[model samples]
Target: MIGEFAKRQGVKKVYGIVSDYQVGRDMWASLKADMESKGIAIAGIDFTPIGTKDYAILLDKAMKSGADGLALIVVGGDTVTSLKQGGDVGLASKMKVMGTMLMDETQGQSVGAGGALGVHSTLRYHFTQDTPRNKRFVAAYRAKYGELPSQYAGEAYDGMSWWLDVVESTGVWDKEKWVDAFRNSVRNDSVEGAKRMRACDNQAEQVGLFGTAVAGGAGQPPVTMKVTETFTAQDLFKPCQ
Candidate 1:
């Protein structure tokens, strides 16, 4: 999705940080191809060994690479490391920084309220989404879990319910058949209300609310986004080739 977004924005030179995982390496290779096909330049590529404690050197390399944007694929401790390193080196203000699911609401806090401001990332759902099905899902989730559901939890519930719907519709539990059904289904209704969910990728296709980390409110935690605009998934994701 980040690659697609960069392509759409006509980004010419892209840089990214990845860990020593196979997925990270594969993603970088794939995006490199995609960008090349689109005539974009990959200005820099940096790989940090997994579980590395210090990122100052890697972050400095990324900053000096003259990239128009940066994508961070490292998660957990590394996500925080990348963010802090970017801020300390003044790269956060110099480049457009985006991240994967690992950089969700929880990790955003660890980067500090001010340090994480204006950083962009994607998610399947947010509690503040205004759809009706989402409202019900939120209410029921809170009723059951005593709080809001994270993106992962919401997607898990939705995936199960979606599978059930497919099973009942087809009267078969064959894995291939169910997969086909899910691929063909169009979810215009969310557990909260009428928010759109894309069946093709099993991802919510509704507009994403752009949020910025702010100081935690009186009973709230340290990191929260002040949603700026709602962007559609169609705008972010391209059809599979």
Candidate 2:
């Protein structure tokens, strides 16, 4: 979806910057292949160490390489640092910034107000998303915890809720039987909406949201993501689905 977004924005060249790790390498490889397949040129793929504090040289290299965008493939703290540095040096003006699994609400807050504008990322959930189901969940969660639930917290809550319900329905103490029940009985109605566990793999097949981070004012989270597209897990799974 990030690649698709770049194409939509007329970006023709991408420079991949990622953490020097297995996860980062794999993701960068996937992005590079996808972009190239779509006829978008990959100027280069560069790996930065986990604790990189200075992205000036890296950004300069990407700019000099003539990349129209920077494809970030790192998450958490490393992602935050690189994004802030990218913003600091006005990298966004030169090239689009985007990545996968990097720009969630917490990371957006870390990016601070107006810092992550035009930064695109893929996500499964966002607090600002407006839906009857999501609204109810957010209200209940904020009431209980005095704050909005992060995506991880929401996932954990949904998992427990589904498990308890499935177990109650099964009315069984047998471990094997319960596993089977869980595997088969996971057409769960979650805050994000209806989702079903793939019976073959027992992985919850949920919808994915692709979005771009936008600036939010004071008293709100540092940034908010505007959903640009949605895709089904089944559509992605293909043969498995």
Candidate 3:
């Protein structure tokens, strides 16, 4: 979906910057495949060690690469620093900024709305999903925690909710039985909407949300993602083997 967004924005080439780690490598690979498959070019790629602060050189390289966008595949604190540096260097004016999990509500808040604004990203969940169940979840969560929940928070809550349901239905506490049940379970009321566990990979098959960072509106946080596209589980995940 990020690739689709890039194509929609006429981004023909991109420079990839990712954390030097297994997860970061995986994310970069996926983005690379997606963008290339859409006929977009990967102009160049670089991996930075986790916790490395200065992104001036990297941001400069991306700008010099003649790419139309920066494919950022960093997470956590790295995301905050690199995004701030990207803004500091005025990279957004030179190239579109986007990639997987690049900007979420917390990171957007940390980077400030102006820094995160217009940056594109994709993830499994966002607090601003306009479903009744998600609306309820966000309201209750904010009422208790005094802020919006992140993707991790939503996943944890959904996992626990599904687990308790399976436990109650099976009338057993055996881990083996729970694992088996989990492989075949589905949650219709998940905060991110309905999803089912794929028996083959034991992965949750759910919606993929694509959005750009924008102001959170009146009485809201400084920033929030405005979902621009939604890919169904069937459209995203491959068939179970």
Root-mean-square deviation of each candidate, in angstroms? 3.8, 2.5, 1.9
User: How well does each candidate superpose onto the true structure, as a TM-score?
Assistant: 0.76, 0.86, 0.90
What is the per-residue lDDT of model 3 for residues 13-132, given as tens digits with 9 covering 90 to 100? 999999999998987888799889999999999999999899889989999998988988887788888888887767677788987888877778789865688788886687777777
In lDDT terms, which candidate is top? 3
Which of 1 and 2 is the better model by TM-score?
2
Assess each prediction's global lDDT (C-alpha) against the native. 0.68, 0.77, 0.84
Off by over 4 Å in 3: none
Per-residue error for 222 in candidate 2, Å, reads 3.0
For model 3, the run of ten residues with the poorest summed lDDT: 123-132
Model 3 has a clash total of 0
C-alpha lDDT of residue 203 in model 1:
59
Against the correct fold, how does model 3 do in TM-score?
Answer: 0.90
Inter-residue clash pairs, candidate 3? none
Per residue, candidate 2 scores C-alpha lDDT tens digits across 1-241 of 6766677778899998999989888877777887887889999888989998887888889989988888888866888888888888777777888888767667877876455877888876776666676788889988898877776777777788888888888787888887888887745467677777777887877777777777655534567677777767754454563
